[model samples]
Target chain A: MTEAVLAADDHALLKTQLSSALRRQKLSAFLLVAPLLIFVTATFIYPIAGMLERSTYSPEFALEMPRTAAALAPWDGTDVPGDEVFEALALDFKDSKTRQATGRLANLVNVELPGARGLIMKIGRGVDRLQPPYREALVALDNDWSKPEIWQALYGLSKAYTSRFYIAALDLKINRQGEITTQPEDKRIFLPLFLRTFWIGALVTLCCLLFGFPVAYWLSVLPMRYANLLMILVLLPFWTSLLVRTTAWIVLLQNQGVINSLLVWTGAISDSNRLSLIFNSVGTIIAMTHILLPFMILPLYSVMKTVPFSYMRAARSLGANQYTAFIRVYLPQTKPGVAAGCLLVFILSLGYYITPALVGGESGTLISNMIAYQVQKSLNWGLAAALSSLLLVGVLLLYWAYNRLAKVDGFKLG
Target chain B: MSLPVYARPWERLWYYSLRAFCIIVLLFLVMPVLVIIPLSFNAEPYFTFTEGMLKLDPAAFSLRWYRDVLENGMVNQDLPVASWAWLSDVWQNSQWVHSAKNSFSIAIGATLLSTLLGTLAALGLSQEAMPARRFIIALLISPIIVPVIVTSASMFFLFAKLGLTNNYLGIVVAHTVFGAPFVVITVTAAMAGFDRSLIRAGQMLGAGPLVIFLKIIMPLILPGVISGALFAFGTSFDEVVAVIFLADYEQRTIPRQMWAGIREQISPAILAVASILVCFSILLLMVMEVLRRRAERIRGVTPA
Candidate 1:
């Protein structure tokens, strides 16, 4: 009985020791990854989070119009703000004018309510010249001061954190009655731009697949030496400068370019009737398809290499025709490659900026170009953040789907 | 595949048509890039073929465009080409040269940083004891999947707030984030094929972990690490969006310079630069191919 008890004690001790060892191993493993995780978190993840936060966090109005925001906080949304709110606005405008921030304040308010910028600027310029009873003075300064919608816009935007920017991003706004509605037809843009971006991306992916499939098959079937030699043709462009390739397309596709010149020489078309191909959607599509075609071919080639010729031969012997044999035995085997290649091309084309910016004229410009315009030209950072967040969510969803369908860890660069 | 000597004319037609289609696709892939090389050597500052070029005249091709690349941004272009002043001017004040310097520095910095961190993380990930492996891998690779414009905008805001905008460190860090995914992918692949028994054998011979890794594992995975570094370098070299947001004029890179050139002007000088870059890419491609073959031979998949 004593011997049995000792053996049980020994077993328990061994279990504890093994468990401790495992814990140590896990700790060491985690320690190895900690540096990169922390670096990526700080440099990448944190920045993105801060950018997303900007969509809802605008402090310009609240900081410059603190008294007005405070005074209007208690006023319900049902009607125009009273005298105290106007007095607070007058005080804020006086301060902002002296600080030279009134213009910025006006721009901030204008983002939420069009035509309010001029009123704010006028009030800012005349705030000091006005006497007491500042409410009537402000109303006299602009008839817009009497409108409830303008006040509502100011009140909605006065908060340090508001969804005004997100609503604007969707091309919708909350009106005087606090109802969410679409912008007028002329002003609605983001939704269509998003759709156009996706459409262009899909078209580019399709073009790449059409061009890449036969080449990949040819490479896979060729002997090793010739296959390796032909692989360089794909990889050369893959490693070439993107701007260079785009420039090459411009050189080749311009009206006075090599292609048009060749066509004219061949009597296929008159020189006066040369096609206008560059600086449009056609140019964007052609250049992007060329650039991304290698991405499709590489994945497909790698996958196709693993498929044996015997399977097709077996299918053919079983009385299937060439097309039927290929469809039944060959196509299904290349599905993962197709999924990976298409997803990669589609996602990349969706985010393309340089090529589109260079070649995409007014009709071809994508949502990314608009986001860039908002950041650089419009200085509408809030809207840019909202658009970017939407894009991020879409990309993440696709990435998750890709992870499920094709393990990203299995991806090979070659 | 060779055409089967089938007893049908249709099969023969289909086989020939397929071959024709593949040849056309291959030509489509290679023609656009190859066409630029000859055009860059044109004597005239034109994108299209000049009459002299079409006639194959001796005066058609000149090194004038190549000279323009050297002279375009020199502070003292009037100085004689062989003079020390001219060399220094080109080194210090030539826009393309300055951008090339910036590109190399940033690419090297980013490559070293990403390769170090990513290789370490990959080593940890290859171990069975690693926790939350898939989630961590996903996070590490997210930078490559996220739209670069989004990443640039976010980095702009963060860097602006931190006063890191217009700073080299900011660009380097952004590039490291971008390049780390390639390193992780490459190193992880190398480690996946690793023979764990070799590591155990070294340990059983009474070697310390550091000695075993340096002597046994490092050499085995060096090709993967080098390829990853090349990828990281290429990514940093080619990147421009982040530079647009985070870099000041002083921090301009090759792609940024090219972007401005393409947007503002189309010159043969740009083509000259493009030709040089194409040559550089070819060199890199050859190096990578040779390394890949060497790696295969080392792994005993091919005869040495």
Candidate 2:
């Protein structure tokens, strides 16, 4: 009995020792990963989250007009606030003028209610001259103050956090009755831009697939020596500078460029009848297709390399024609690569800025270019953040779908 | 690839047509890039072949564009003296030279930081005991997959808040994040075919973990690490969007200069820069190819 108890004790000790070893190994693994994980979090993920937070975190009015903001806080947002709110706003505007912050406040309010910037700024310059029937004086200052929508917008802006930017991002606005509705037809821009971005992205992806599949097939079927040499043809451009490639496309596709010159010299068209290719949708589509073609071809080639040629031969022997053998027997095996390539191309094209900004004229400008314009030119950071957050979510969803469906981890670059 | 003896004429025609179609596609891929080389040498400031160029006249070609690359942004271009003073003036005063310096410094910084962190993480990730490997890998690689505009916008807002806008450190950090994924991918690929038993053998010979790593594992994976570093360098070199959002005049890079040049005017000087960059890319591509082959040989992947 003592020996049996001792044996059990030994077994227990062994189990504990083994678990401790396992724990040690796991700890070491985590320790190895900790530096990169922390670095990525600090540099990449945190900044993105902070930026997305801006979509809901507009406190400009609250910061600039503290008294008015405090006064409107407890007031229900059903209708316009009472005279006290107007008195607070008038006082705040006077202070804001002295501080030279009225422009900022006007800009903030203008985002929610268009034409409010001019009215607010006009009233701000003359606000100190008004006598103390504050409501009547403020309303008289700008008849726009009579609209309950302005008050509702002010109340919404008074909050530390609001979804106003997101609403605007969707090209919608809140009515005087606090109902969500589409922006007036003249102001609606984002939805159409989004549609155009996706449409261009889809076309580019389609073009890449059409061009890449045959090249990938040829590469995969060739002898290794010849195939390796040919692979460089694909990869050289893949590794080339993006600006170089875009510039090359410009040199090739412009009005006085190579393609037009060649066509004219060959009597395909007159010099006066040269094609308008660059600075339009055609240029964007063409350049993007060229740029993204290698992405499609590399993945397709890798997948095709794994598919044995005998499958098509067997189909042929079973009385299938060449096209049937290709479509039925060969193409299905390459679905993963096709899915991966298309998703990669589509996602990349959606966010393309440089090519579009360079080649895509006003008619072809994408949503990304619009976001860039807002960030840099318009200084509408809140709206930019809202738009970016939507794009981020869309990209992540597609990435998740790609991970689930195409297993992009298996993808390799040559 | 081999036509069967029983093949019909239509089948033969289809096969030959497919081959022809592929050749056209390949030409499409290569022609644009090749056209730029000759255009960069054009005496005339034109994008197309001049009559003299088409006729192969010597007068049609000139090194004028290449000279413009050096002289365009120089402070004292007409300084007739071709001495060290002239060289120093170009180095210190030329805009392109300054941008090139900025690009190199940033690319080097980003590549070093990314390679170190990514290599360590790849080592961890390849281990069986690592927790949440898939989730971790996805997180690391998300920077690469995320749209650059979104990333740039986010970084812009955050950097503006942090006083990091127009800051070199901010751009460096941003580039490091962008570069880390390539390091992870290449290092992990190298580790995939690694023989753990070699490590064990070293340990059995009384070598410490560090010693084993240095003696056995490092040599096996150095090729991958080098290739990854090159990729990281290329990424930083080619990047412009982040520079647009984060950089000021002081941090203007090669791509940023190119962007401004393209936007303002398409000069032959820009073509010269493009040609130089193409040559650089070719060098990098060759190096990567050589390293890849060496790695395959080391891993015994050849079908000998």
Candidate 3:
């Protein structure tokens, strides 16, 4: 039978035609795609790479005060060895104000030792002294100031650019006084916060999936005209502003809002009831679930639409009950939608800032909230970049993991 | 085994219950946005019951807030008295726009740059020529995945040295970067349904690559191009962080201004602006749908 089928296939002509068409297609595609390649390279790739370089490359210590950095480059930590190093430091300091260079210098030294700030400040204070032992005086103001550790800090800061910020973000500290250490156990808050962010995101995504799946299934099975109208309702939130949606939630969930009023009127709760729903983690979960439910529903409905009714009927006819048929057969078929919806919700929730910031009290804030505070309020770009890098890595890892699972499971989400 | 009448009764009950449940879900989803349209005209800006309020207070129907926003020109009048108060005089000291002209200029410039980059990306991506296309596409659009805060934080120092910070160009560049990925995604989807034969035919007809792009490819993907442009415009218009970090005194966009307004004062003016934006987005969504349908017709794909 196979041989008979193969004999009728006309394979040679098909191969020849397919090969020629594909090559022609490839060349045409490359030509058409060139401009976009160049544009992405310049705008997307170049600028971000430039940003990474700017953050990691220490130019203050290495680029601006090269000669001074060179002079201190060879000094071992044992002694206050070279006058030339001190002279170079003084010259760099004299040419610049305490404001411009000193703060950056402090940041570099800060990587190694927490007390480096005071040491650097003392050095700045002694810069104007006209004494015989001025170098010794500056170094003696803090004994560690002359230690190779201080020089390293100065040299590090002087180079003006490095990945020290990135290092600090991971909660690792460097020091001449001590080896790089995990931030003191008490101060190590970010890791916990990062985990909390993931937990919250996962919970919200789960809530959305649970609430959306049944509704999407029902919607998909509806008559076409009714489904279209219902789908519009599902999508109406997309037309509303995000700010408005969040603000509405805030109002609705508040103590004096319609929800509480209704509860009181129906005698579901006391008239004196004062609920604390809007400012806590529960509020964050509820609001996010509401906002993201449609993301889950859309994917589910799209997938469920293509699911043939025969599959379930076949399972049922095979002596399986309706519940068993759905659990074993229909659920597996909905995997693609489940994956897509979960991915969308998880990814979006990971980066969510505005809603959590507005509604989330201390317990509800996510990694995005911390990142915002670092940039806008604290003005700590290095730490912000560090935290952001962590979040980025996390998101990429989750995406990669999901894609790998999909590949292994033979699940293709459109 | 059961009679049809007995079995049919249970089915009817199930169907009715399902329909009722679906209707309730629909009502929950649509009510919020529909509520706002009428509430925008409400004398009270608060999201409370308005029928009784509107009936008792005819003065509330007066477009006083809208008039105040337009005539007082408050959006252009003072720097929002918060973190942005320091930036109130930025234009006098720099080339930033203190007027609506500046906002228009920045949005337009960012939109153009982003659209060009994004459309090209979409076309390239649609062709599927590059090695490891999925991986490359993912990386290329990774900006959207990297939260905006991270991008802004990283760009702050980079732009500062490029002398792009605190200037119009700086804000525009930041906006362009943020907007490009959305453009890429939308345009790429549009190009996915596009036929490759037309471009091949153009090439065979002796048109140069650029000519084929302008005369053949562009017209075919024009809807995608337009969609990308609209997305880019919205992205820039709505961006807050990168502009907040990169722009100094002169380059405040509407969102940046709004952020300050929210923190510093309780102005109803923001609601007016937001109402306008809601209208704009709806109008824009309509246009995108029309273009999408037109593109489908050109490609000879049956409309759903």
Which one is best on DockQ? 2
**Which window of 10 residues has the lowest lDDT sum in candidate 3 chain B?**
B90-99
True contacts kept of each: 0.71, 0.76, 0.34
Assign candidate 1 its CAPRI class: medium
Clash number for each model: 0, 0, 15
DockQ of each: 0.70, 0.76, 0.28
Record all residue pairs in model 1 with backbone atoms less than 3 Å apart, i.e. clashing. none
- In order of DockQ, best first, we have 2, 1, 3
Error of 3 at A120 (Å): 4.6
**DockQ, model 2, C-alpha based:** 0.76
Docking class of 2: medium
Candidate 1 Cα errors over 4 Å, as ranges = A1-7, A74-79, A114-116
Tens digit of per-residue lDDT, candidate 2, span B231-300? 8999999999999999998999999999999999889888889989989998999999899789878877
lDDT of 1 by residue, A380-402 (tens): 89999999999889989888887
* Interface RMSD for candidates 1 onward, in order: 1.7, 1.3, 4.5
- Per-residue C-alpha lDDT of model 2 across residues A1-414, encoded as one tens digit per residue: 999999999999999999999999999999999999999998789889988888889778898999999999888777668999899999998889899898888888887677788988888788879889899998888877877778887888899898888888899977656689999888899998998999999999999999999999988988877888888889888899899999999999999999999999999999789999999999999999999999999989988989999999899899998889989999999998899988988888888999999988887789999999988887888889999999888889988887876654574766
True lDDT of residue B72, candidate 3: 46
Q: What TM value does model 1 have? A: 0.97
